[model samples]
Target chain A: MTDKPATPRRRGAARTEELLQVTLDLAVEVGYAGLSIEAVARRAGVGKHTIYRRWSSMAELLLDALSRAWTSDLDYRDTGDVRADLREQFLRSAPALSSPPIGPVYRAVIAEAQSDAALRATLHERFLVTVEQRTLERITLAQSTGELVDGVDLEFAAEVLCGTLYYRALLTDRPIDEAAVDGLLEMFMAAYGAAG
Target chain B: MTDKPATPRRRGAARTEELLQVTLDLAVEVGYAGLSIEAVARRAGVGKHTIYRRWSSMAELLLDALSRAWTSDLDYRDTGDVRADLREQFLRSAPALSSPPIGPVYRAVIAEAQSDAALRATLHERFLVTVEQRTLERITLAQSTGELVDGVDLEFAAEVLCGTLYYRALLTDRPIDEAAVDGLLEMFMAAYGAAG
Candidate 1:
């Protein structure tokens, strides 16, 4: 009886992931505004209720799609050295950051987030807050490890660094390159190096 | 008689500037998709033919508007010093850059540029290419004055600095503060500072 129940539960979980994949593909193809669960269900060959069971609204579905699409969830290593760890983390995320699918999705969601209150709330809850908190944690770790200098305001540094990267992604038509990444890391390191 | 005639031309140009301001305000309020010449005419209380006589198309009108809105036309100054001039230039533009109206218009145009080929062409021709050219000229002035460090690539530096600022406008929820302005200036100067 236990084995029978476990097998069906495993299958249901797998089906949910499959449905999510289909939803993301639709989002990437048509954009956030164009996305509909009906289209997703049709594409996924799943039922409308199946989608509704998991996500109550389109914004929730889109947010889930976005969170799933965030491919850069690497370990935030202390490594007893801030600069080296940052460089590694940035470099590791570079390929994912530059991927074609991710770029358009990110751009669309960001634009949509500006207009949609629910999306804005979901974005803050699921992505933005987590990103800010995690980054602050890493900076704190660096401060504790003496990797960053004394009196270095971790919050400001986090904003500056992430702000620079996100700015590159949104404003300029150029692709985020290796040298630019290296330069950002070096510049921040140099600025905060004296803080410790 | 000719000198008197020139005064009317100047007055006409001033009226055209006012018309463009109305255009930008409309563009920000109703986005590019919803923006129409008829709506602009209604808002400006200018006759439709008046706008049509001056500009052939919506694209042309937008180009004229953008050109008029670019109030900062600073020529690159060579004072045999890069850091000081850069600081001055950046600080001077900070207020203009931080203006609430300009950012929303810039984003609305950018979003429109993504899917509209004609809009993209106008954006590049009227704004981006010219900005890039002028920025290069400024960086060249820095190089010539012997203030910019050797081996600092002019175009990349310009992109990094300008792109970072634009990105800040595009993404961050916070208002543009003096610290960010100073931090950006510091980053650019540090990256390009020559050993004295």
Candidate 2:
């Protein structure tokens, strides 16, 4: 292999990845309230301007870090049984949401968003909206197949599904365990399951 | 009108009320992040020790303030119709949750709880548990009256009911409006309503 200097584009991309990684590490350790660009720059051995140039605020930077690190499969696998599909998806993703790197950081952003409307909008547009829309699509498909009830407002159904898990995860000390998932599904099915 | 100095007990009680009131006012103005015992004392024209003698932490003091100002009737009005009762309660309390004083301050405290486990537990024990339990009681009564489905785990039902409203209130900008409330109740009724 020829030993040559990396291109500016390659160097910039590498730096960006490094910054994001460092941000994730710091978020898990100190949480959102303790995180700042200055701290990230110090940890990454870069100037604050480097981070500011890429992201306007700490929330934006943290959002990118979370989005990059969020590797869980968000899409549902249609197992022909809509209930089974939802159960599988939640069982897979709930742990990631309640655990490190993503969990604490995401909670911090949500907390900060209570005060910052712009961040709230960004979070909804970027993360929550995607999750909600995916849920709606899955349930809509189920409705079409006659697996779910017809002529009902499925958007509210979607919100309840996603929102309940988030509530258990973010607000309460309750576990997003199998029991919780099953209970939620039971209610959903009872409400939306088509007449046999 | 008191022509003489108030008794020590009376004065202490008055001071406590003043401190809690000041705490609520400050919480609404600056949010939990901007709040401190020092700021509350300064604003209330009292020493920090005066505020500290009664409450142990800012969160505790804030909790007291919230409890004091929380005037909404948490109990459901047994209208015999379970859906109507729930709808009435949600419509009544949702405005308090989304509006000034309570809304912003409560959001800030919830946000702070993400980082602090003690605060989280306190919030759960003090506020969420009460709401959840009351909902359980209401639904349990309905179940007994042949309104709700029997033999189902109603605790989970309670969580979903309260949790969805909270999810909408705190996480998303979606208004907890009549349609939203009605949609949620429709699902609940569909799931839990006793088979005719």
Candidate 3:
């Protein structure tokens, strides 16, 4: 059989995936502060222009790497019990955030965002907002079904629920384990649970 | 009047104060990522050895600067009400965190800490631990007084209380405003408030 030549589109897609994987590996090894286009290019054996052509800045490139490597489902499962669903989701995704390529890289990005306004907005728009919105959707649905108390500000509740996890994960040495998750959900349910 | 010659102790103390002030100013201007002993020396017109003499590393120097500039009272006032005290404290100290100098510098250090184990430990030991402890003390007292619900984990409570503010401050663009504080306290009270 004759070998078929790869089309330009296929080649471009393959190259993009390779570059993203390289970016993730470098991020895990050296962190975001140590990462630069030159370092990635050297590691990938590609010209600096090859990276710049694909990404306008290091933040963009790193974010793409994060997006590609993020295998956890951001959407919450509708398990009928809102608290159980949130607990399941938190437990499922906590490892990705607490360890490895994702945890360290995410921390670097958040840290960088402290100094970079443009990056902060992008992170908010892309990642945090999605999580917050999903939490809100789940909680709002529960409220509508009379599973939660009416007249309470569900938005604030959503922020606290999501905010507490990020707080434990990023700010302190405290583990976001079952105990922590239960403590949060207990407070949440107490505050928002329907009057029985 | 003839000028008195300064004692070496006084001179040394004054020089230390000046260096700290310079460090704070530069931290506000360039942030933690841009800060270095060399840069501080250049800005203050002192040799690098001067900074090295006082602080072993940039993290040490920055932490000292933070300690010096941290004028906000970390201790909660025993105003006979746990919720009110927390609200007052959060409101009183929110500006120091959300505004320049302390806010920006602290965020930079936190970002740096993600990859730096030593800095993270120092931060947790020197700053976060103190805040969490004080919070625990106040809440524990409230529980004893029957102001808060008994049997709840106050340590976890303390973490969430402090963590949520930091989450809004560092991780998201959400304003740590009166509304945010009130909402947090509301959930806290609902969950932990003594039942009538």
Mind sharing the TM-score for model 2?
Answer: 0.80
Give the per-residue lDDT digits (tens) of candidate 2, residues A83-189: 99999999988888757768778988988888777888777766787788888999999999999988999998999999999888877777889999999999999
Query: For candidate 2, what is the total of clashing residue pairs?
Result: 0
- What would the per-residue lDDT of candidate 3 be over residues B40-113, giving only the tens digit for each residue? 99998999998888888888777777777774567589989889999988888877776777887887788778
DockQ (C-alpha) of model 3?
A: 0.53
- Chain B structural similarity (TM-score) per candidate: 0.68, 0.80, 0.77
Q: What is the lDDT of residue A80 in candidate 1?
A: 74
CAPRI verdict (incorrect, acceptable, medium, high) for model 2: medium
Predicted structure 2: lDDT = 0.87
lDDT of 3 at A39: 94
Best by lDDT: 2
Off by over 4 Å in 3: A1-65, B1-61
Give the worst 10-residue stretch by lDDT in candidate 3 chain B. Answer: B66-75
Model 3 C-alpha lDDT per residue in residues A24-47, reported as the tens digit of each score: 999999878899999999998999
Which lDDT value does model 2 have at A86?
97
Write the residue-wise lDDT of candidate 1 on A112-159 in tens digits. 655444565666566555556767788788777677676645675665
Q: Name the lDDT value of residue A140 in candidate 3.
A: 95
